[model samples]
Target: MKLPIHPIMEQSFAVIDREIGEHKFTSGEYAIVQRVIHTTADFEFAQLIKFSPGVIETAIAALQNKTPIITDVGMVRQGIANLVAQTFNNPIIVAVEEAPVALPGKTRTETGLLSCWRKFPEAIFVFGNAPTALLAFCEVLKNTSVKPAFAIGAPVGFISVVESKHALAKTSIPQIRVDGRKGGSPVAAAILNALIVLSC
Candidate 1:
C-alpha cells in the first residue's frame, strides 16, 4: 500500500528542505536525510538507520562540504542502540528526555547511557534530560565538528503529549512526527517508524 504525506507532514517537509538546502549541508548529509525520509518501510527498516552520530555525521559533513547526514528519529532508538553499536564504525550520540523517578535501580543507569555514549566522543553523547537540557546539549553540539542530527523529546504518560510536541517545535530541527495529543514510548516509536516510511 502506498502512503501519502499527511497534510501536516507536507508542511513540515517543506520547512526541513528549505532549512537543509539553504544551509547548504554536504551532499552526504542531504543524502542521509533523504535516506531516512525515504528508507524502505520493511521488517529490516528498523535496523537500517541511526539517530545521533550516524545522522549527525552527515549534517556536519554537509556543512563542511564533505559528506551529508542521512537519518531520522523514530520509536526504535532503544533497539537501534545495539545496531548502531555493531554496524556503525563511527562515533554516535543520543539524547533522551525523561523525568526524575526516585527508585533504587530505576533512576538513571550511568552504565547503559554513559558507557554507550563514551564509545565515540567523536560520534556520540547520549543525554537523558528535559527539553531545556536537551536544547542546551544541542547548543553544545553546535560547537563541535559535526552538527546535531535528529532530536526527539516525546515523553510517555501524564501531560507529556503536549510537552513533547512543544519541546520539539521550539527547535529548528527537522523532526518527523505527527501532531495530536498522544504520548507513550510505544506510540511515539510506532509513529516515528511509520513516518520514516511515509515521508519517503
Candidate 2:
C-alpha cells in the first residue's frame, strides 16, 4: 500500500522554504539543514547546525567515490536511505560489539570505536547516539595519520554531546554536525541522505 506520509513530507518542504528565507546557507548547506529539520522537526537547527567551508563538496566527492561510512550505532546504519547505498555503493561499518568491550573503564561505544579505528582512517564517521564514540573518534584521528572524509558527530545527550561536536568542528577534518544535545540517529542519517541526494 502507498504511504500517505510521503505527500505530507513533500509539502513540509514548501512550508520550510516559506518559513526560512534569506538564510546564509549555500544550496548544499540548505539542503542538509532542511533535511535535518524535516527529520527532527527542530527549527532551532537553523542556528545550531555547523559545517566547514567545503564540507558539502568534499562529502559529495567522497560519497561519489564510495568512501566507507562508519557509524556509532546500528540505528544510524539502518537509517541510511537505500538511495545513498545504491548510488554511492559505500561500505557501512558499525562500531564493534561482537564481544564484551575490552577497554578499561570504557563504555561499549568507546571500546567498539577503538577496535575499528585502525581499520577505517578515511571513513565518514557518524556518531548519532554515543558521545563517547565522537570523543573517541576525535582522539583516534589525532593520534593517527588517518584522516576522515567527513565527520558527522551528532551524538545526543547532556553528557558530552555539546563538547564532542565542538571538538569536531575545531578539527582540520571536514565535518557536518549540530551542536547541543538535539541530535540523534535520524539527524545523522538525514545528513547522509541529503548529501547523497545532492551528490546524485
Candidate 3:
C-alpha cells in the first residue's frame, strides 16, 4: 500500500536531518532517526485512511473513561495533559526522572520517580528520556501488567534518541516520533497533535 506522509512528519524529518547534519551524531544514528520518522508517518497515515474516525473516537472515549495518561517529560506531559483535558476528562499522570516537592522556599523536589506510576493502574505512558531511562520504563512495563496502545520514547538526541528507538524496537506498540538531536516540548506536542488530527 502506498503511504502518504503527513506534512508535519515531513517537516519533522527535515528538521531532524538538518539538526543531525550539524551535530556529532554518527551516520547510523542519523539513518535510524530517518527510519523512525518514515515508520511513524506511514503508520499514522494508514490509520487515518483505514480506520479514520473509529480509532480517534476510541481514544477519545478512553480518555472520557478517565484513563490515565502517563508521561516522563514535564513539558511533553504538559502538552499531553492539555490535550487530554481538552479532548476528555480523564486523569493524567506524569512520570519524571524526579518528583516534585512542596517545601517552603524550595522550587522543586523529586518526591519519587516511580511513585507517579501508582496513579494509574493501566494507562498510556509517553516517555522522552535517555536510553537508560527509556529502557527502564519499558522494563517496568514488561515486568508489570500495563498494556499501552500508543507509546514513544524518542529522545531526539545522539545516543539517547538512538537508545529510545532501540528500546521500543523490542515492543509491538504503535508509536509517534520525530528525528532530531534534541527532542523538546515542540516535538512531543507536534506528535500528540498529529495523533489527535489523524485519530479524527
Candidate 4:
C-alpha cells in the first residue's frame, strides 16, 4: 500500500521534479534521489548518491523478506521507524545503543556494529552518523563471510567519512552510498524510506 503524503510534501515533490529536469536516473533510482532531495532540500545529493549494480532490486527483495535492519545510531532508526512499522515491521537494531561501552580500540558504534554483524550478518546495515562503524563494517566484509543484505554508508563528517565510503565501494556487497561528507541520518533514512516504498 502507498503511504499517505501530506499536501505540502506533494507540492514540494512537484517543485523538485520541475526543477530537476533531465536526469539519467532510472525510475527506481530517481525515487530514491527525489526522496533524498526532499529530505534535505539539497540538490547536491542527486549527484552525491551512488548505487551498486542491481542494488535497488536486491535491497527491495531483502526488505520484502523482512531482513533485519541495523543502524549505527538511534537517529537513523527513529527516522525510518514509522515507515518500517507501517510496512515490513522489520526489527530495528541501534548499534550504539546495543554496545555495553566503547571497546578498547573501537568506538561504541563500531563495537556494536561488529556485535550485530556476528548475529545478523545478513541484516540491512545503515551507517548514518559514524564513519568508524562503516569502516569497521567494511573491514568485516573484507575479512569474513558476513555479507549484508544491503548496506547504506552515509555517515556525515570530515574525519573518516570519505575513507569509509571509499572502503564500502571496494566491497562487492549491494549498497547505496553518499560520497564525501554530504550524508547524515536524514539522508540515510531517506534512502531506506525510498526503498521501503518501492518494496510496497
Candidate 5:
C-alpha cells in the first residue's frame, strides 16, 4: 500500500532534503530522521536521534511479524494509529489507559507499561512522553530474560528523561533513542511511520 503525500508535504520534504544535505545516516535512518524533522520542524533531531546496530531491520521484521505495540501514553498511540492500521495493524496498547491506577511507588503510566510488558514482552515498546514509564520499563528489561522486539526511547521532559534514555542505551535491546530532552509523541510517531514506509 502506497501512502499519499500531499503537495505541501512534498514541498516540505524537498526543503528538508535541501537543508539537510550530506548526512551520515544510511538511507533508512535518514528517512526516519527526515520524518521526525518534518513532524517537529526541528533540524536538531537529525543529530539527537540515535539507532542501535541493525535496529531498522529488526524493527521492520517485528512490524511485519505483527508484533504488538505498547506506547507510554495515549497521545503516542493516537499519533501512530492510522499508519499502523494501514500497515501491520498490530495491537496498539496505551499504557496509561491499560492501568486503572498507579502502583504503590510507580506512576500510572509506569504501572500500565509494566502490565503491558508482562503481557507482551516481545512487543514493540515506544516511550514518547513519560520518562518514569521508560525508566520503569528499563528496569524490567534488566531483570527479565524476555525482551521487547524493539524500543523507541524518546520521552520529552527534564526530570528523568536523559536518565531514562541512558538506561535504555545501556541495555542490549535494539532501540532508537533521542539522546537529550527534545522528543515527544510526534517524533516517536514519525519514526514508526517511517518504519512502516520502509517495510512496504
Candidate 6:
C-alpha cells in the first residue's frame, strides 16, 4: 500500500512549520518538535516535550548503526515505521509480554522490562504504556555502568508516570519525555520516527 506524497500534504507540512515558527525556534530544535506536533495535532506538545541536550544526535547515530529499539508494549513496537526498521536493521523488541516473569501482583510490563534491561543495556528504550517499566529500567541503570543510545520515556498514566519521569530526568541518562500524562504509543513512535527522518 505504498502511496505517493500528495502536493497538498506537502503544503500542509509547510503550514505546520510556519505555524510553529511563531515560537522562533531554531531549525534544529523545532524540526523534531514539528514532527511530534504533526503526529498528534496537539500543539501543547511543543512545550511539554523535553529532550536531553544530545539525545537527538544520539538517537540518530543509534538508528544509523542498526541499534535495537525496545518498547514497553507491542503497540509501541508496531507503531514504528516499517521502512525505518527495515532500512536500519533496527529491530523493534517487545517480546517480554508473552513469557514474562511470574511476579506476584506485578504487571508483566514491569517484571519483563526489569529483566530485559540487563540483556540489551545499550538499546534505545521506548516506553509509552507503563510507568513501572520506565522506573524499573532506570533502577537497573542505577547499579550498572551500562550506557544506552537514549530513552524515549513517554509513559502515560496518572498513578506514577509523572514521578517516574521526574526520577528519570534526574539521571545522567539521555532521554526525551512528555512532561505530563498526555502521551501514547503513537506519540512515542512518532518521536523516534522524527529522529530517523531528521538524521537523513
Q: How does each model score on lDDT?
A: 0.36, 0.83, 0.50, 0.95, 0.93, 0.79
lDDT of 2 at 140: 73
Per-candidate TM vs. native?
A: 0.34, 0.92, 0.55, 0.98, 0.98, 0.89
What is the lDDT, from 0 to 100, of the residue 165 in candidate 3?
A: 60
TM-score, model 4 to reference: 0.98
Comparing 3 with 4 on lDDT, the higher-scoring candidate is 4
Error of 5 at 101 (Å): 0.9
Ranking by lDDT: 4, 5, 2, 6, 3, 1
Enumerate residue pairs that collide in model 3.
Answer: 99-110, 99-111, 156-181, 157-181
Q: Quantify how close model 1 is to the true structure by its C-alpha RMSD in Å.
A: 11.5
- Candidate 3 per-residue lDDT, tens place, 1-200, comes to 12356698778778656644564423433333354445444322222211212334444445456666666667766666655555554555655534555334321212222455555535655555444445555556667666564555545556556555656656555454443344544445545544543333
Q: Give lDDT: candidate 5, residue 179.
A: 95
- Please report the candidate that would top lDDT against the real structure: 4
> What is the Cα-based TM-score of model 1?
0.34
lDDT of 2 by residue, 108-184 (tens): 87788877777777888888998987887887777766688888888888998899888787789999888888899
* Candidate 5 minimal-lDDT segment of 10 residues: 1-10
lDDT of 2 at 184: 90
- Candidate number that wins on lDDT, 1 or 5: 5
lDDT of 1 by residue, 161-194 (tens): 4454454455554443323342233433433333
Predicted candidate 6 versus true structure: per-residue lDDT over 1-200, tens digit per residue: 23244597567678887776677555655766777787788889989888888887788788888888888899887778565654676877783573356478767888777666767889989988888888878787778787888998888879888988887898898898888888888888878877776666
lDDT (10s digit) by residue, model 4, range 3-44:
888899889999999999999999999999999999999999
lDDT for predicted candidate 4 compared with the true structure: 0.95
Taking all chains together, the TM-score of candidate 3 against the true structure is 0.55
For residue 128, what is the lDDT in candidate 2? 90
